[model samples]
Target chain A: MSSRDAILARIRAAVADAPEPPPVTRDYRTAHVDDDHAAVVDLLAENLADYRARVHRCTEAELPALLARLLTDHGSRSVAVPPGLPTAWLAAAEGAEQHLDDPEQPLTARQLDAIDSVVTGCRIAIAETGTLVLDAGPGQGRRALTLVPDHHVCVVGSADQVVASLPQAVPLLDATRPLTWISGPSATSDIELDRVEGVHGPRTLEVVLVG
Target chain B: MSGTYLGMPAFPQAAKAATRDTRLRANLRHATHTIRDKRARAVGELDDWAVLREAGKRIKDRTLRHLDTYLLQLEEHVTAAGGTVHWAADAAEANRIVADLVQATGETEVVKVKSMATQEIGLNEALAAEGITAYETDLAELIVQLGDDLPSHILVPAIHRNRGEIRDIFAEKMARWGRPAPEGLTDRPADLAEAARLHLREKFLRAKVGVSGANFMIAETGTLVVVESEGNGRMCLTLPETLISVVGIEKVLPTWQDLEVFLQLLPRSSTAERMNPYTTMWTGTSEGDGPRDFHLVLLDNGRTDTLADEVGRQVLRCIRCSACLNVCPVYERAGGHAYGSPYPGPIGAVLTPQLRGTTSAVDASLPFASSLCGACYEVCPVAIDIPEVLVHLREQVAGQPGHRAERAAMQAATWLFEHPAALAAAERAASATRALHPRRLPLGPAKAWTETRDLPQLPAESFRSWWQHHHTEPPTPPEPTS
Candidate 1:
């Protein structure tokens, strides 16, 4: 028999006498924080900031200027833009060059690294954990875009994109799509268990919350 | 598995040298204590941690009970999703399959995400033997690989090394790999991380093949999850043309929804974060996205044997959170290398002996390494009764051959205890020779035990004899109070 079949058979025989597993009881709270929507968004901002991600709150009209100013502040010479990102987001940043993500002619890793920053919109944001989920959906391009760049300026819609907890966020996501959940900038506690951010992923994550 | 642990002594012998190293002891004590307090606070923040832990345990139990069905389902779905699946019964077969897959790609080098399964099977050594160079991208793993050291902790492999030592390793060894460390690298953690980032970035971009092990394999949708902090996992899982994930069969979760429970438990219990910095999940292959060619190697290497034992089966539920290691007193002192495997601490004590059977002296001694403090069980995210499993494994080890002398002594003591007169006489004889008794034994197993510990002084006389002298006759019964 093939190793697959043999291994399956062994598992079967091993569990032959095992009793049925007890039913799972999920009595845990779905959302650990208050039910108020504004409170949830506030909590999200607070938690995100706590993890050292620069959190910004602005209106849709204010987003373009904020993104531009952030680029200027970080002195990004060029920015990588996802295919579906609104062009206005980069309108104010006249000095920075913009590179769009194209499926047929994708930017190479080296090229992406050379780019000063990546600006993408997230699918959802979890308030309790201060997490942003990118499904490589409309605004968030493939995994490499956010990863290869040194700085990431993610635009999250506060009204529709924010959720209270992981349980609430999990259902909203499509499992079939590749998901990148980012709580903070790429960080590592590998050296003497002290957390030091700015690793292989974006060294700086600037999340812009637009309502 | 790897030559790394070959010719290693038993736990006691290994622990002897480790315990004497005051620097190692301090490093472990500081790291474990820091994480332990943080984990407690993290768990305390949630009101229903117990409920979540139970749910996690039950989900894993349900998956393991019907593992055959789930694994087959996983194979079918993964195949349907534009990926190939291979099954290996042991380490050698798994290594061969990976080597052949990498060879087929015509790639001489592969960038790897830190994976416990690959480490368990010694995949790096296997690849190296086949003339394939595997680069470890995780910072701690890089420290271990560069320093030619074994991983001491599951989460932080280089937990044994302080910042100064890490800086030295990077400065001395980074050039041998690819990029040399910047001139005069300091001992700052940030500087060390930057050095690793600069060193590994080139490899991530140029590598055609990526090797990984998933934290969870959702059989329902055939999606694999790699939970990590650094973007190294992202670089490997995405940028490479070909991706190979060798995961243990026990890592399978029945559905994507099952991740809800574990996703919460793992991050909090592990890094004490509400959520890890990055958690990447992909179902097989995707167009215009991650790796085009994907291979999933389902490894059985002693998992089926572990499952056959009812009391031992619960260990398979471990999520590799490393919480048990942080809370374990024995692990805090003896350090990770003494365990002599990639897995260390309380989980290693129960797991290594089962995975690699108790036939070897090192494996046999692992069961007795713990003090049965139950601290490991208290902090376990899945609530694995680690203490119970340790005792069960101890019984298994003691029953095996080469324990005749210890077993005989136990039986002799039991017999003497059963006979009061003989026990008293033996105690009296011991008391009589108290003046001649040495502080430490000079030879045999007793000597090994007494080498570091002083033998207790014998009493002047047996307690039974003292009681007899105090009251020659039985005292009259006092009036009963109703």
Candidate 2:
């Protein structure tokens, strides 16, 4: 028999005497934050900053100026623009060369590595854990778009795209689509258990919460 | 559990030497205490922590019992999503599969994410034998691989090394691997981390094969989850052209929604973070993103055997969080190396013996390494009664051929207790001879148990005699005042 068959047979014989496990009792709260959207977004911002991620709150009309200033401040000459991103998001940031991602001709890993910053809209922002979930949806080009680059300027819609907890976020995401749940800029605690931010992923994560 | 751990001394011998190394003890003490306090504070933030833990435990139990069904489902979904699936009955088979896959890609070098499953199987060594060099990218894993050291802790394999030691290792050994450390490398954590970033960035950009282990696998959708703080995981999972994940079958969750419970339980119980920096979830392969070629190897080295034991099967409920290890008094002192497996501490005590079996000296000695303080059980998110399993394993070990003396003593005591007259006479005789009792046992076999602890002092009189003397007649009941 094949290894798969053999393994399944072993599992069957082992669990023969075991009873079926009862359905899990998921009494845990689905949402930890209050229902107020503004408060939830505030919690999200607080958590994002707590993890050492730079937080920028701006109105829709002010997002372009904020993105432009952030790029200039970071000395980024080139920025990766994922497909379907609002053109207005980077209209004001004309100084930086924009490389728009084409799914038909996606940039190679080396090419992506050379880019200085990536600006994209996230599918949702989680408050409880201070996480951003990018599913390669419209504006979120691909898993590697936000990765590989040194800086990430994510635009999260505070009005509709913020969640209070993991339970609230998981159901909203499509498992079939690749998902990247980023809580902060890359970090490591492997040395004396001290957290040192910035590693292989984007070293700087600047989240712009726009209403 | 793998070749690297072959011929390891039993827990008692290894732990004996570890305790003598004051430096090792200090490192373990500092690392474990810091994480333990942080974990408690993180878990305290959620009022429904108990419920979340309960849900996590149940999800794993349910998944394990119906693992075959879910495995079939996962295979179908993965195949449908443009990925290939392989099955391995043991570590050797798993290693062979991975080696063959990497060779088929015609790549001599591969990058690795820190995975307990791969560590348990010793994948890097196995690949080396096949003329392949696997690069470990996680900062802690890189430290262990560079120093030619076995991982001592699960979450932070280099937990035994302080900042100064890690800095020295990197400065001395990094050049031989790829890029050399910076000229003026210091012991500062931020500096060390930055040095690693510059060193590994070159490998990530040019790598063609990336091997990893998943934190959780969603059976319904065939999505694999890798929870990590560093972006090494992202680099490995995304940058490579051929991505291979060698995951233990037990890591599979029944449904995607089941992720909610474990996602909450793991981060809080582990590194004590509200959430890790990155949690990458991928199902099979995306058309233009990640690796176009994806492979999932489901490993069942001794998990099936572990599942056969009703009392010990709960060890499978572990999410590799390392919370039990952080809270364990024995782990705090004995250190992780003494466990003699990739897994260490309270979970290792029960898990190693079951997965590897009690045939080896180290495996047999593992069950007796704990003090049964129940601290591991109290902090276990999955509610594994580690102390209970330890005693159960001790019973099994005692039934082995070498423990005839202990079994004989237990049988004699059992008989003496069954006969009331004989028991009373024996107790009185022991009380009378209490003055002659030695503070420590002279028997060599029992000395290990008594060395760290003092044998209890026998009372002057047995409780039976005291009860007779104090209550010869039943005391009259007091009248009700009302």
Candidate 3:
């Protein structure tokens, strides 16, 4: 027999006399924050800032200037732009050159690393854990674009994209699509168990909450 | 320097040497205490932690009970999603399958995400024997690999090393692999992290094949989740042309929804984070995105044998959180290397013996390594009741033939306790010879027990005799009011 068949046979025989497991109890809190949307967004901002990600709140009209200023302030000469990103978002950023994520010709890791920053939109934001979920959907490029660059400026829509907890966020995501859940910039606690951010991923994560 | 665990001494012998190392004990104490306190605070943030933990435990149990069904379902979905699936009954088969896959890619080198299953089977060493280089990408794993040391802890494999030691390892040994450390490297955590990033970035970009182990495998969607703090997992999971994931059969979950419970349980329990920095989920091969060729190797080295026993089956539910390790007093002192396997601490004490069987001296000694403090049970996300399993394994070990002296001693004590007259006589005789007793036993296996502990001094008279002489009155019968 093949290993698959033999292994399955062993598992079947092992659990032949096993009793049925009890039903799962999912009585945990779905939302740790208040029901109010404003409060949930506020909690999201607070949690994001707590993890050392620079959190900013601005109106849709102020987003372009904010992006431009952020790019100029970080001294970024080139920025990675996802294919579906709103062209207006980078209208004010004249100093930094834009590199689009082309499907036919993908940017290599070395090329992405050479770029100064990456800007993308998120699918959803969880308030309880301060995580941003990117599904490689529209406005969000592939996982590598956001991972290889040093600085990441993620634009999140506060009114529609913010959820209060993991349970609330899970149902909103499509499991078939590739998902990247990032709470903060890349970090490591491997050295004497002390957390040091900026290893192998974006060193600085700037979350822009657009109202 | 050789990174090998072969021919290591049993637990007691190894632990004796570890306990004497003041530096190692201090390092372990500091690291475990820091993580333990933070874990408590993180878990405290959730008002319904117990409910979530119960849900997590039940989900794993249900999946394992119908594992055969889930395994088949997973294979079908993965194949449908354009990924190949292979099954390995033991370590040798799993190694051969991985070596062949790498050879097919025609790549002599592969970057790897940190994986316990691969380590459990000694995959890297196997690849080396086949003339392929496997680079460990996780920072902690890199430290272990560079220092030519066995991993001392899960979550943080080089937990026994301080920052200075890590700096030294990188500065002295990194050039042998690929990139050398920056000139005049310091022991700062940030500096060490920077050094690692520069050293490994080139490997991640140049490698054609990547090897990984998933935290969870969704059978319904055929998706694999890799939870990590650093982006090394991402680099290995995405940058390579071909990605191979070697996962244990027990890692499969029935649906994507099951991840909601474990994702909450694992991060807080292991790293004490609200959520780890990165959690990447993908279903098989994706065009123009990640790796084009994907392979899933389902490993069953000893899981089937462990699943066969009813009382011992709950161990299969472990999510490898490492929470039990931080909270264990014995693990805090004895350290992880003494366990003599990839796994360590409370989970290791129960798991290694079951996975490898109690035939070897090391495996047999693992059950007795713990103090049975029940702290491991309290903090276990799945509520494994490690103490109960330890006792069960101890019984199995005692039933084996090599412990003749111990068996005889236990039988003699049992006989004496069965006869009251004999027990009284023995107690009186022991008390009479109390003065002749030495503070330390000078001979045999009993001397090992007395090496660090004082033998209790005997009293002048037995309690039974004293009670007989002082209180001669008969006990009063109680009146029934009802």
DockQ of each: 0.85, 0.84, 0.85
lDDT of 2 by residue, B1-482 (tens): 23388899988778878887888889989998889889989999999998988898898899889989999999999998999999999999999999999999999999999999998998888999999999999999898888888888899999999999999999999999999999999999989999999999999889999999999988889899999999999999988999999998988988888988888989989889999999999998998889989999999999999999999999999999999888888888888999999999999999999999999989988998888999999989899989999999999999898867668878988999899899999999989999998787887767765664568999999999999899998998999899
Model 2 gets an lDDT of 0.91
The best candidate in terms of DockQ: 1
What TM-score does model 3 score on chain A? 0.98
Candidate 3 residue lDDT tens string, B174-223: 99999999999999999999999999999988889999999999999899
TM-scores, all candidates, are 0.95, 0.94, 0.95
User: Tens-digit lDDT track for model 1 on A1-211?
Assistant: 9999889999999999999999877788898988899999999999999899999999999988899899999999999999898878888888799999898899998899799999999999999899999999888999999999899999996578899998898888887899999999999988777788989999999999998
- Which pairs of residues collide in candidate 2? none
TM-score of chain B of 3: 0.93
Q: After TM-score superposition, what is the CA distance of residue A143 in candidate 2 from its true location, in Å?
A: 1.6
Query: Model-by-model lDDT, in order?
Result: 0.91, 0.91, 0.92
Q: Ranking by DockQ, best first? A: 1, 3, 2
**Candidate 2 displacement at residue A161 in angstroms:** 0.5
Task: Rank candidates by lDDT, best first.
Answer: 3, 1, 2
Q: Which window of 10 residues has the lowest lDDT sum in candidate 1 chain B?
A: B445-454
TM-score of chain B of each: 0.93, 0.91, 0.93
